[model samples]
Target: MIVADLSSRELRRRLSDDGLYLHSGPFICRIQSVLAKVADGLALAYADYPLADADYADFHLRLAAPRLRRWISPQVQFHADVRQPFLPLPQQQAYAMFEWGLNWCVSQHANQYLILHAAVLEKNGRALVLPGHSGAGKSTLCAGLVYGGGWRLLSDELTLIRPADGLIQALPRPVSLKNASIEVIKQLAPGAIFTPTVMDTSKGSVAHAKPPSDSIVRQQECARLAWVAFPRYRAGAALNTQTVSVPQLLMRLAEQAFNYSLHGQDGFSTLLNWAQSAQAFEFEYSDLPQAIAYFEQLASQPHTQLQHEAAPV
Candidate 1:
């Protein structure tokens, strides 16, 4: 049975320039979004939800409104409200940040959390979080992990990380795939469930993969921070681990983090602690099969852990 709750939609009598709609399920705090209208009038509607009761734009009406304020951690305090004046069209960029930023805030307050810019996948005895920027082959890499590598995907976008302690909390959500990665993953993992393609956006025709069944089944299971591999898709770079410096890695991650600095020093320290705790690597490669092999190899070594040791002289 699908459990759900939602909020109130504040409408401007005038049609919005881009016609954007973002809704958060009661069970989930982050906004689920779709640009309602496109330059060509291509529409993306969620009227037909697959589950028992789907989310809508009016969850705040519930007698118990979300404690949105309490949800915002001190380190992650920021303002984003529809009450603010409207902006220009093509709302995907800001909207993407909004949808995920709210999620980062809401997730931080959960018991023991740390939100990560990573893709999480469960393998033999562990879970892997591949955190990287836009061009990083995280989604495509995660696609193979779920399909061929026998791992359950936690998320193809963001993974929750607890700041208090260094636990990689599972914020199991659908995996979003863009243009090229879409066909790649589909060909590799034929059985993967996908939401309808929402066309005419900044990212060009986008879609989401239904979260892996295991993430849904054990929704409460929290995966620890195991591997933090910052991957890059080089056209033909040799499959190798280009060690990402602790400071540099954290720097790159901070730039991409929604609440990295929101948590301020705490956020910085949280990331630092995480980098030192997990196996950190900057993977550069073009072959998906070889990357999978690399993970397989890394997972086989004894003590296989890659914690930070004092830098040698």
Candidate 2:
């Protein structure tokens, strides 16, 4: 069902409380938490027109960050104070932005364990971990992996790594698709549910592609990270495989880290120990077939050559 179509007067009515609206493309998110479906969304008061010099990420970091904590509580209070009934157009518009910001928090919080920025897929008792940075074609590769490689997408953004065991946790978050990538995925997976596209985000005209039903259904069965493969998408670069230096990986990963210092020396030790057990590689490819074949081969190697992603923070 559609949530509130916010107006200045209606927004003022909710002055006593805050509300959340989730808009993704055509669909309005009816968040189903344990307490309620949040049919209209948890009552959180918001402005008719909030700050927007940047994308939803900036809004989340700036406005919502103050209300949020680095860690959440078990019975966390959601801003629930709505005065008027749900609206249509405006609610959807606001939902589109709020949804992204909240999801970003979920991902960042999960990363408290490890700095995982990749698309993850699991199937047949195996989880394929693709670790990379922005503009690395990680999302596009992920779209290909799930659509062609016959795997379940665990995440398209953050792959939360458990600090103690170095186990890669599956964070079932939405996939962020850019202009062409969105079309590419729709062509590949027609049944994929995509939210509304927000104009002029960091990557330009961004949208969120949701997780597969199979992944959602099996969300409880956490997949143990079997292999960590670093993917790189180069326009004209030939397909090549090179060993990534351990120290180099650590440093790079630390830069992307969300909470490396919070865990202190123990966090470093855990990551290092895990690196010693996994094989590290620099996967560069201009062609998709070679990239796919490369990963297929890595799947065959023994999991004895441990590697690191970013160096010690």
RMSD in order of candidates: 9.7, 11.5
Candidate 2 per-residue C-alpha lDDT over 45-126 given as tens digits, one digit per residue, 9 for 90 to 100: 1111122212122111212211243244212222212211222212223334444544555544444456466677775666
Residues 11-85 of candidate 1 have per-residue lDDT tens digits of 111113222233222233312222232111111112211232223332111111124433443111123333212
Over the full model, what C-alpha lDDT does candidate 2 score relative to the true structure? 0.53
Query: Distance from true position, residue 161, model 1, in Å?
Result: 1.5
Question: Which candidate number would show the highest TM-score if scored against the true structure?
Answer: 1
C-alpha lDDT values of all predictions: 0.55, 0.53
Error of 2 at 55 (Å): 32
Segments in model 2 whose C-alpha atoms lie over 4 Å from true places: 1-96, 107-112, 300-313
Off by over 4 Å in 1: 3-114, 307-313
